[model samples]
Target: SQTIHQWPATLVQPVGSPLSLECTVEGTSNPNLYWYRQAAGRGLQLLFYSVGIGQISSEVPQNLSASRPQDRQFILSSKKLLLSDSGFYLCAWGGDTEAFFGQGTRLTVV
Candidate 1:
């Protein structure tokens, strides 16, 4: 069985601060990893994705960056967070057809 975990389910940060969020998967190897953000009433936007370790593709360029340091670990980081960076961040992994999402991390910037 495969499962994903994320920390600090909710966070409130001041604008212009740094941000780091981590996600890890268990019971899978070399699975495709993806980072997505969902805004209020908006569709999900892919931020980054990795096909393997040390291989990442950025779908959108903003105040965010992603890295894959291990086979099943993905990290999202921001050097200086902006007010617009606030949203629901999700980590997912799947194959050619389906993907599973984490509970998601809700970030609120003020």
Candidate 2:
């Protein structure tokens, strides 16, 4: 049974602060990993993705970055946060056509 875990479930941060969010998977190997952001009343937007360890692709350029160091571990980071960076961040894993998501992290940038 494959499962994804992300945390902290919620966060509140001030502008210009550094950020780090982590996600890990179990029961799968070399699975595709993705980072997505969903703004209020908006749809999910892909932020980054990785096919394997040390292989990452950015879907958007902003105050966000992603990394895959282990086969099942993905991390999202930022040097400085922005007000627009506040949103629901989700980590997902899958391949081909379908993906499964984490519970998501709600970040509030003040």
Candidate 3:
């Protein structure tokens, strides 16, 4: 079966602290992967995406970076946290027509 694993369902971090979130897909190869952030009561914002190993595309520019270290793994990282960074982060994998999402990570930066 195909599934996506995303970790640390919720987080609270002090401002200026570092952050890392991870997601991995199983039972699929070369799926397009994405990282999205949803602010309170707002639509989702695409942060990063990857189509293959070592190929990443950034949809928005801010305090975050993403990496595809392996075929099935994606990581989102930040050097410093900001209060505005707090949100619901989601990881998803897709083919051309459909996408599946992981249970999101809710982040709060204080």
Candidate 4:
């Protein structure tokens, strides 16, 4: 079965703290992976994406970075957190036609 798993489903961190969020996809290889942020009443914003290992594309400039350490593992990290960074972070993986999303992590930076 193919599935995507994201962890620490919810988080509360003080400003200037560090953050690391992870996601892994199973049952697939060389999949297109994505990291997105969703804020209340707003559409999803693509933060980073990877088409293959070591091939990351950033959609916007922000306080976050992403890395694919393995074929199926993706990580989002931040060295210093900010209150404005609080949001619902999502990880997804897919082929050209369909995509599957993880449960997501709700981050609150104070």
lDDT of 3: 0.96
Q: Give the per-residue lDDT digits (tens) of candidate 1, residues 1-110.
A: 99999877999999989999999999999999999999984799999999999999999778899999999999999998899999999999988899999889999999
Query: What is the TM-score of each predicted model, taking all chains together?
Result: 0.96, 0.97, 0.97, 0.97
Model 3 lDDT tens row, 31-58: 9999999999589999999999999999
Q: Which pairs clash (backbone N, Cα, C closer than 3 Å) in model 1?
A: none
Q: In terms of lDDT, which candidate is stronger, 1 or 3?
A: 3
CA-lDDT, candidates in order: 0.93, 0.95, 0.96, 0.94
Residue 92's C-alpha lDDT in candidate 3?
100
Model 1 scores a C-alpha lDDT of 0.93
> How many clashing pairs in candidate 4?
0
CA-RMSD of model 3: 0.7
Candidate 4 lDDT, 20-86, residue by residue in tens: 9999999988899999999883799999999988889999999999999899999999999999999
> In model 3, what are the clashing residue pairs, if there are any?
none
Candidate 2 lDDT by residue in tens digits, 1-110: 99999999999999999999999999998999999999995899999999999999998889888889899999999999999999999999998899999999999999
Which runs in model 1 stand beyond 4 Å of their true positions? none
How much does each candidate deviate from the true structure in C-alpha RMSD? 0.8, 0.7, 0.7, 0.8
